[model samples]
Target: MRRPVTRRVLAALAATATGAAICVAVTTPQASAAVGSATGFATRNGGTTGGAGGQTVRATTGTQIHAALCNRASSSTPIIIQVEGTINHGNTTRVSGSSCNTAADVIELKQISNVTILGVGNGALFDQIGIHIREASNIIIQNVTVRNVKKSGSPISNGGDAIGMEANVRNVWVDHVTLEASGGESEGFDGLFDMKNNTQYVTLSYSILRNSGRGGLIGSSESDLSNDFVTFHHNLYENLDSRVPLLRGGTAHIYNNHYVNIRESGINSRAGGRAKVDNNYFRNSKDVLGTFYTNQAGYWQVSGNTFDNVTWSSRSSDNNPAGPNPTSNTSISIPYPYSLDAASCVPNIVSQTAGANKGIRTSNGSCATQNPTSGPTPGPTGNPTPTPSQPSGTNLSIGAGSDGSSKASGTSYGDVRDGNMSTAWSPSGATGQISIKWDTATRVSRINIREASGSVGNVRAWRVLNHDTGAVLATGSSAGVITFTATSLRKITFEITSSSGTPRVAEFETYAS
Candidate 1:
């Protein structure tokens, strides 16, 4: 929603050009002149030039200044555009000229690649993005400050993107850039760049983005699932109203970044096919990170990430009943929120299960019930068998049996652990045999199951019930241990039942391959 500054208005300003002429002229210094011809621009303190195409034209406005550079010859030859002083436009101020037409904007990158638009030592500021890229690639926009971009049309429109990159650009590098937005109703859109569609191999690093809407840094997919391969690292994000950093889709690597004072989530990965996230820091945020609602089974490796004062939540649309669970396994090793100091720093491991339960456990107790006969039962065609009901606080132990020999029980389907615990089948009311179907072929060897209870009738019998064929695997009574081996299916469930009187089981622990 950025307004275009027309060439006709610049032509009018050129006609009234007066004062010191701050023309963008390239000059080689004596030292560098001997080494090579250095490229740059020379301009007066505060003045304007006219004309739109010539290398030496004057215009009274920043828009005109930008137009002059756009009209330069040789797209491969880098042009040096300089800002004389500050150009004020209402509440907005710019280092160079502002405004662009569709034709004029496209002309800026007609055939350019290695272009470097350096800012003045004091840097430049604009109400909107300083430069917007379209159908351009291998570009580097560095050492610049872009601030206070106006929202597009309204709150709903796509506006205030600091640098908008569209139309299949590639191999771009944005470094050492600073973007700040005034925190109000006018939220900043994309910070360094807003990319979509077939844009690949881009890198955004060593930048500071603060107070942006939607995302501080974003890579999006507009329908066809753009194959974006972006890398974001060593950046600092502060006061982002929404998700500070995000990977919308494709392959992305996010690492070593710091997020502070975030409102919603620190980092969000939505609809992305595959991503690798590691070694990042999230401080004082509502939820530290999230991955949700991907059409395909998305794969994410979250490792060695640190979170202080962070909250976590998860919800998914996949009708698996077990919920969309993310695995940290052994690679996630960040400290919990309650253990960190005000400014503590901790290392993030790649495969540690530190925050695995942050999104899964809503409340502390189990929601299991025992129905003797009457209850809403599942349809015969797709329903699992009925499991037994047990009370709470049941204690079951596992060790060498009365004969001082180990007994084997339970079955493993695919790679998943099902029906290994005494209470697993009780909550689901699955009676009879318990079967497992693995999504893929898997090899599992060892298994362990334990039930904990206080009194005699408080202990119930437990067994593995396969929902597929309605068959029970290993059955046991009272509080005891069971061990066995079996292959696991991709998806399966466990079944439990009362052996004698209804027993109270406090915990059901299972260890399996």
Candidate 2:
């Protein structure tokens, strides 16, 4: 059974989508601010809020990571560890403590709860080392890279998996990370991300797993069926041999991911594993989806997926490819809310936002990045207009072209300049921008913004900018006559920086006073 949803997930969606900081904790040497909110299955089981409002520390080596955990007041005490520089076997050692179960040559998060490991500054790289999570809950690992970890080599760690979770793990989120290997198990490498032994309520987002034989697995074997409720979205899987991943049992929601160059197989859902596959992009792959290697008969509910140049094998006891022409074989009911990008745009979006050291950027659910402005601007303090009166002068926006960073469904960019109060434009999220453009440069000192009927008091803060020069024209708290020094510009943008609700703009009028 699925867990209940809470208000924390909604708050995270609002804050991160609006480019507002979801402050985990801020201390010297590291800023514990999350780049994006938790989505997918992680929003379940009371939501994943790792180390929020907890003590923050900094770490430069793997041993320091263990030390921070060992130094915590208790195993379940919330703590955020901001990591930087390279962490390898040379600097990692087991630290014995009541709060930690760490080991040498690896970053171990064992028997712990409410902890966060975040990469900061030049970023954290686990070179030839892996992260092992065992019997842990409510943990997060973000903005880090783990590469070339091996199990059978001279320098082995985490049994060769880049990141492995097992033994009753729950509510863990791993985001904006990169896990890669030199080759496969024959080359001393293993799965990039693996979960087994009753693991549940986990999410892996905005990550890249490449150049490995196995991407990951849900269960250790066909009978290890207790693991379930995993989500994989906005990830890139490239140059993988097979098992991307080999799902043995339980349910997985895989969407908006880009898969390229699969040598043998992809998404080997078998042993009764069920996957809800949606809006994914597969290019140059072989047997991208199906029940492979096992006859246990896994099921899939496929929709909106694009298979470009993906090859399929004949249906047999060992190979059952879903494609050649894929269709849904089962139905799944997802519990949480989410936005899906078009399959055509998955590659572009994942390439820019996935992996580490990418400034922790995320999609605004509308295929646009949230941070388009130069820097953070202060919130508006001007008094609000309870009811904005229509301006008298000629509305310059009536005939101008209109565009925006993003728009809500059933709303249009043209609605803000349409001159009809009944029709309006609303952003996909709490904050967004709407701009008016002209064929030639236009000059105006005064502008009036009229909010839509039901959304009058929704807008809390706003800024008018000269879109041509990226200059702020005026800052205010409400929709009304906003005045600044008369300047000529080809385009002007009215950006809603913060809002109490989903604000809507009925009309944007410009006048020369």
Candidate 3:
């Protein structure tokens, strides 16, 4: 059970401060790199190195943080702000400037880019305040505590989210922070960490989210499906009711995290979303993984996870819990590099490393050895098996079967092999997968991928995978003639990893000649 927060102290502080501004002048410092490199999906999409190679400033109030953004020469100018002390609505105000768009009553990082807010000195606490990031990119928020935020209380901010990102947000790395609420949505608290509205390439690592009704979510609803490519690693989630993320639609890699006392549910992937959940420990939780509250299902690829004293709910149309003996419903191929600490060690590693003011310690992602620093090694784990050679022949896919990770609303997975150049298949997002399958093992080494007439050149990068063995048969940029060592398999997947637009494949022709 969580204790109620004492708001009287904070209310008195808010009352003492008048509407007058607290002037704190700051000078631009020498250029420097970010305090730490981003990991996971945040390392993708040109990487998130917030406030590097520009300037550094110190702030004691939320207003000063906004002033730093407003004072930048340009909205994209890189700047780091080290914050100390408490930030509430009273000390936060709207700052007008050409380079920034800010608002009162919340810590707003809106319509800006390349900024980092780091807590220092005695540590920064956003008491009853929320940090909102919207229409922003290349941002980092670290080593702070945000608590007791509410959407329906007398003093409200950020709709009760401790840290919320939305509206085309990109490349955000939120690490080493603590986000918590005293109670559930009925008590006026919402999600602790949330992203929506086309947000992409974000990572939340080495953090703690506890005692909240909702832990977080990727997309806002079943219809709001534009968000994708997020990662959650080495974090602690405890005493939460549900939505220990409610993933609506996206690719989320949740690894090396510790989940405890999840009262209702956890990792609720629904509405065609896919989650690669690996190397995690779930203890004393109920329905920790599954598609619940909806008939529309989601998917997950599970590996190396430990469940202790966890309970499962009975199967129903509105409650499908992946428990008792959870297994993979879909195979998710991760495009980034990562290392996994053994599942047995996740609880210990996360306890020592997750959250703010803990020396920013992290598990080296190796169970045998624990290092003080963070960052994953190069090369991806859980790679597919090696591809073997095959014999030359004609088009093997002409009469073969087809499937995919996802398909666009108007398209079908079978359309990739219908041999009709006009009818095509597209992913639900800008990037996803399409595959061809057979009842028996088949051999092939070549594939001619014909793009839809209007969608030609939409694919930027791709990989040919042996879906049967999860092996990387071939990788290249653009779709055309793809060749590799012939491999015999029941299924082969053509995965579009990067694209400028939603890719459409008219034909996925397979050959062996």
Candidate 4:
């Protein structure tokens, strides 16, 4: 359920800041109190009064308030900047572009320490980025919603990330905040929150990210200066569907989050860093799991998670572990009649020799054990259809082109690359009365179909064409494009039979759709 940010909460925030100002004015010594509350500022509604702690300057615009606050001093005893009303910047106010220029309206904490910038609930809309902390320490940005922040100005380029904490900044906490629609132009949104370059001890929790091109949180280091000890817990990431990579980092804890309707992998671990991904629910993802680089010294523990109606391979290998029994505690549960590649599930631990070795003890369970009140049995061609099981190390080649080029028969329909191209399956024919074969390649989730001939009748059913065995693993009458989970990577063949009582054979395509 979505939480509402009410006006009453905003009123309370204003009241709290006011109360703090009164207490600081009365308790501190005359000299110290003067330094704290020196400036006598007026409210946004235009009332002038000398507040105890610094100037209580209220600005209607977030940009105006941020500029005023950034102009403060670097004293050890910093002034508190209390904000009232929504500060809309960048695209939040439907501005010209996606992001606010960092140079124009950025709040830089230069050589400043022991400061708090408090905002009313939805009081400040850090449009481009809520706050940018660089070369400073002991900073806190709480109860803020940073939306529509772009890293770069170019619309074509993938820049303008929402929040950036660069350089030697330490002891930073971004809590009770929301980062959404930040990253990617072709996808939903485009931007990234980069916490890099020796930036350590950062905690981002209780946030919501939706319709973003990238994942909710990204912690990485371009330099080798060890960006570590970041925790991402109790956040929601949904509808982050884009081609760009999401969640790339090293040495972090990602737990207790809800991920829904992501076009790409739900959570990704790239680089050589170690991460603990556990206690999360991933539902309706284009691809569930992926690893750009694994098998390093650090540990990647994926345990105690639930997956429902996920697509493609749940996990992939970028780099496998080198030691004996390095990976551990990973499990998955799917509906009945759903099968996964056994080889992909095996831990990538290296033995003494240079061969592939298993490292972790993984388990699988059925959803029926938990959901007793589940619906009726699925049909044969439904999500839980049976798949053919094959041994490991099988060679399967999938090709998509306009020409009718059969890899198995060595026949070319025409210029295989030209014409209205569609993805085609090789070695067409059904082995038994089934729709798919499994256990050949590492993974098979979905297939993209291409219609070469304008007539679309050339393709009959979305069948799993096996090249090595020269048989069809599975056959489904559903036309256009079809996606199913298979155990292995076997060469898939599409049966291009005449659908309109004519010899209709055009270019058909298939991929992990």
Name the candidate that leads on lDDT: 3
**Per-prediction RMSD in angstroms?**
26.0, 13.5, 21.2, 20.1
Residue by residue across 1-513, what tens digits does model 1's lDDT show?
Answer: 423323321222211123333333443211110101111010111111111112223232354444544444434333334332333343121222222222322113323443444334333444343356666555554445666655543322124566666666655655445666666344434454566655666666545676665454345542546756666655556677664555566665666566666775555555544456666666666655555334433345676666655655555563111112334422322211111111112111100001110110011112221221211111112212222232222121222111101111332221122223333322222222233343454333222332322122222345654434445545443232333445453323334454322222333333333
What lDDT score is found at residue 230 in candidate 1?
A: 65
lDDT per residue, candidate 4, 1-513, as tens digits?
Answer: 423223221211111212331111111111111111110111111211112234333344544443334434423334444444555444221111111122335454544444445443224455554456666555555445566755555332124455566667565555445566644655434544556666666655444555677653344432343565555544455567632222344456655455556775445555545566656555555554555344322336766655545666433344332112123533322111311212211111000000000011012221111111211111122322211122233222233222223332433443222333452223333211112233445354444333333222223234555554665555543233344655354445455442321222333333342
What are the lDDT figures for the candidates, one per model?
A: 0.40, 0.80, 0.81, 0.40
The alpha-carbon deviation from the true structure for residue 343 of candidate 1, after best TM-score superposition, in angstroms, is 12
| 436: Cα error in model 4, Å | 47
For candidate 3, the C-alpha RMSD (Å) to the true structure equals 21.2
Better of 1 and 3 by TM-score: 3
On a 0 to 100 scale, what is the lDDT of residue 211 in model 1? 62
Off by over 4 Å in 3: 1-33, 368-513
Candidate 3 colliding pairs, count = 1
What is the overall TM-score of model 4 with all chains considered together?
A: 0.45
Model 2, position 102, has a per-residue lDDT of 83
